[model samples]
Target: MTRTTALVIAVAMTFTAACGGGDDAAPETTAAPAASPTTAAAEPDDATDDAVTDDAVSDEGTNDDPANGATDEVAGDDPPTEEPAGDDSSTDDSPVADPEPADGFSWRAPADGEPILIGMVNTEGVPGLDFPEMRTDLDRAVAYLNDHGGLGGRPIVMEHCRAAGSPDSSQECAQSLTGKGVDMVLLGLDIFPGYTTFSAAGVPVFGALPILRSDYSADAQFVTGGNLTTMGVIAAIAVEHIGAQSVGIVSADNIGANTSETDLTNALTAAGIDYVSIKGGDNETDAGFQALIREAAAGDPDLLVSLYSDAGCIGAMRGRALLGIDTPAISTAICAGSDVLDVVGDDAAGWMFVGVGESDDSMASIEFEAMLDDGSGDGASGAGLGALAVTMIGTLARVANMLAADGVAVDGDAIAAVMASGDAPGSFPNGETIHCGVVAAFPSVCGFSLPVGYYTDDGDVATLPGFDSVSAIDYLP
Candidate 1:
């Protein structure tokens, strides 16, 4: 399954868990079929296998009621209530406060004000790669932002357009959004290499995750670091935290995957760690996956890394478990989804991922949960793999705050100016500040820092210690 599908499944599973009263039942154990050592040595080469397609690695990129469309407004519109100083009793005429949750995040309602339109372009309707959940999350985030004092007290109006995973379609969507006179644009994970459409139209574009190479360098686009930068962080963690002397990498045999592998190899070599890499088809068979893992394990490397798609991740985990290999493993956050957990079961317990921030406990995470509680974002029982929705919400809030603080009119030109002036607002979920154009090659990557985390059998994540510094690894192209 693709990451997008994994997210949909995860949201559905979250609802199931919630309906089941958050039970902590353990997954049933099953005996996996053992693989022979000869099977590993006789694995077919990926270079000549046409059957192994790159569907899983293709970057085509959940959901509450599953039926409630993005048009529905979130609940609560009252301002945040303040407690009386040194007094417990409330006045008979005083307005009643909203009940606080056990997690301690105070909820507030969207402010009443003029609407500011923000455009969004996402890939949807393409076979095996639609992301309607992203639009839904954006809608929920806008509603929440409006309740909590939206852009200078102006409510946000979202104008959305869908692309069919093609450059022409992406360009058309950009035009459609611009025609609506949107103040700015938010991009979802699109493989379409047409960011220039937005830049040429003079609209400032930002996204939770960057997928294409153009997205990393476009002057008008900004994104939280995508797979490339995340790989660098992973390399740093392997050498620093895991104390890995040697690393083995398995990635899809695609252009994007190739670029990621090269960057990761550079980072590892720079850190003085020896490494070996193998490429496999994006939709590798179970035997293909086993061969890749066995080859990596044969080296007795301290760390085994998987940069494949969601399904590939599942294949790797299963392969590892079947072989009874216990070498510590790490992968991108794409692997930490519900589908993978459901498939791999206990095998996912110690699999670590490079993430943007600490999970569940960070200030940003607390705010993210509060927004979800107020009927914003996906409203899943737990924050899933990517945290894309949370990243989008936090990024937009910072942009809105920057505009508010400067008394600048909310418009494409003004927003672009604010971003270019290097006065971008707010830190990442990990409390790391973002300065656009920090790296000359990847100019649009606003934040370079990342946190590490491992998965729990319950589909939750536990944070690990690693490189949190943008300067820890060099990311020059």
Candidate 2:
């Protein structure tokens, strides 16, 4: 199932527990869900707490449900005490394994092949902002790679580190991954401030999502979009396609969102488009969003742009709908989430946004769909071409393709060398090409262009004709 579907299932299952109002007793303690094998280094208990919170507020609202008075009737209900001799019941009572694929979607690696170890760092355990799904996606991609001719016939193995949205946790993960002799590091939507650690150790780091200043300029770090290029594309679309000569921005009050605002401002000014920017809380309330939207629209902007998180996006859309404003609207990819769309309903239709990959019928997209169908990657989450599944699978596929082309053994040093040689593969999952070190301000940004798409009345995103390349836009120093 898609990530959206999975989230819906989770929400349905817990809706009663979240919204039930009659109970007044303490809730029962349940076993935490198991972390995916790829997240081997994560603290299970800590991660589980965040996961539960994410599920509880998947739609970002509070319910008046009193604590359920449920308790374990049999406190010591562990497994049976008796052992079943040679054929132990506990050991042998395994579920049936999934049937092997009957088509080409099967593992092709030699059984005894050497393993190619790739390190991954992701953010998790931060309440309401964890991304266990990122690690899960990478794990699924590695499994798919191993099944479809592992990197140069070597099985791909991922060693993961959980940053948990803290500098210390990030550093610890970097240090641990470096010490493990990993070939390269994949930064999966991490807010870690420790890319320097990997760079100092001469390890090349590839970013699935570039969310920090270091992500743009760090030596040996290459990312899908450098320094808000994706936002730049959104700005371009606002001016070019939407006929928006004057634009207003509702930006999240965060470092990354501020950077995006600056980038977009530069692009809009260069294009001779008039623009005004206003800041809002990343998790603004409905009233706060209405006021911000009204204030921004008061200037008679031709278009409204939301550079906030999904929550802020929902608020902005609701605010606009309430005011009956019809100005063309656009948002960052994060704002186009399934939850946001569901909340906004028909109001989301005709809104434009930027994405990293194409939704077209390219061979890559076809293969990606097949992988998802075969359960090879985490279902879609995130926005644009760099959705969780796309980024994980695309980044790894590029790496594997590069190694296979050179007939080189997959090793850390060799991979780093290739990345630094200025000839590393740059094809994204959406069939876009990126060249690292091409921009002075964003030296490590690979893909500097983004695809534009509009939401339909049915809440589906439809890609426009072509992508917007903002390479000429000046970058902030």
Candidate 3:
């Protein structure tokens, strides 16, 4: 799922509950229904209290019977009893190995020099939605960098601000950071980013992913592509990989979902393929999911694409299994998360997931594991979005080092230039070559390709053949 979709689901639910529909709204940040690899942003642009209403799902001449609530309630919808687990397996025997930090993605040792003050903004301490781990992970990475000889020997200092998941708080953060004279700003799950404030102050912004339209065209750029890029890749998979002549798409009926569905349909239209769209509420019961899936599969298309995440993932998988509908389905990486997989078990089979792939023993993966290690024998206690934080900071470090090596000032302007220079460089966490400005529609998105995978019979995600890192440029609108 993209940042906007994830934010919409969480924020929309909160507002709905505030408006006296508390029972219907999804609660807490536990396991977000659709928190994908790029999720961590705040509330969405058009997500209001009404966005979570039952009327959001159209009758569409399909649902005549009353909605009988599902017995197998999906996790992540209710208030979290314990801290939410990471996307990786919570099982005892995991596949990831905890190796020492590798040399490839490691930051260079710098001569001791002046400290480079960096500003970071994140959403935290909110009632229903809060993720302090986003900040904690970045702080850990900053400390590690400073310890390892700093940037060009210049120590890195962070000026952190916490947002309360509101535009006022977000703007306050931007305004507050500008006064601190920080070189640049890093955004971590800011719902309504104060981009104009930073732009006027000549402060360049870098974020984990695009959360709104302003994020794409503003002075900021993102490490990961958002919904547009993902939809493009889905289109590529539908037309080129699966050889799908026709497709059925199912998604929640909201601004974010509508936008993403439109994006996919546009690409499908351009590719000359037939498609039917089915929209429903963000949180649906088991029977509701079955109804939606039955309607979608009624056409017997070559493939099924789902834009649902979190509990919806469980519902979809269970609905398919119960109905015996085996048509290959494609969804965001969130649908493949361990939270959902642990619930669905073997029912997760036959679903292809985009945005995430298998956990390999590559140098990049090793470095990622090292960053999460707390010195205990166990792996990273904080993985999920914290991993995103590590990747973003590591990418910034790599860019800064590149500029310093070329005898240029390692400041905001130079860093921005290198990102928009149209040159591809090895990115951290995966070491995949990142090419920014590849998609004209989203110039700020640095990721042109993403790893695609499918679940095996054992309910584990594996890299699909010939789709380890498929580019979305060719299929994008």
Q: Residue 27 of candidate 2: its Cα lDDT?
A: 16
Candidate 1 vs candidate 2: the TM-score winner is 1
Instruction: TM-score each candidate.
Output: 0.74, 0.71, 0.76
Instruction: Write model 1 residue lDDT over 1-477, tens digit each, in one string.
Output: 112221111111100000000111212332111111000000111121132222221121112343322422333332224432223345687666533111112242354566766777766665544666566655545555666666555666666667666666666777776666767787754555356666677677776655655666765444356555566666767756677789988877776577667767878877788999988886888899999999987889888888775688789888887888877787765565555666777777557655522333333444444444434444442334223554555555666555755677665566556555666654423444456676777777666655554554445544443233333336334
Top candidate by TM-score? 3
Candidate 1 RMSD to the correct structure: 9.3
How does model 1 fare in lDDT? 0.53
RMSD of 3: 14.1
Cα lDDT tens digits for candidate 2, 63-150:
1111210011101111112221233234466763422221111323331357666777766667744666555544544545555555
1 or 3, which is superior by lDDT? 3
* Inter-residue clash pairs, candidate 2: 107-147, 108-147, 183-412, 355-384, 356-385, 357-385
- In the order shown, the candidates' Cα RMSDs to the true structure are 9.3, 15.4, 14.1
Error of 1 at 191 (Å): 2.9
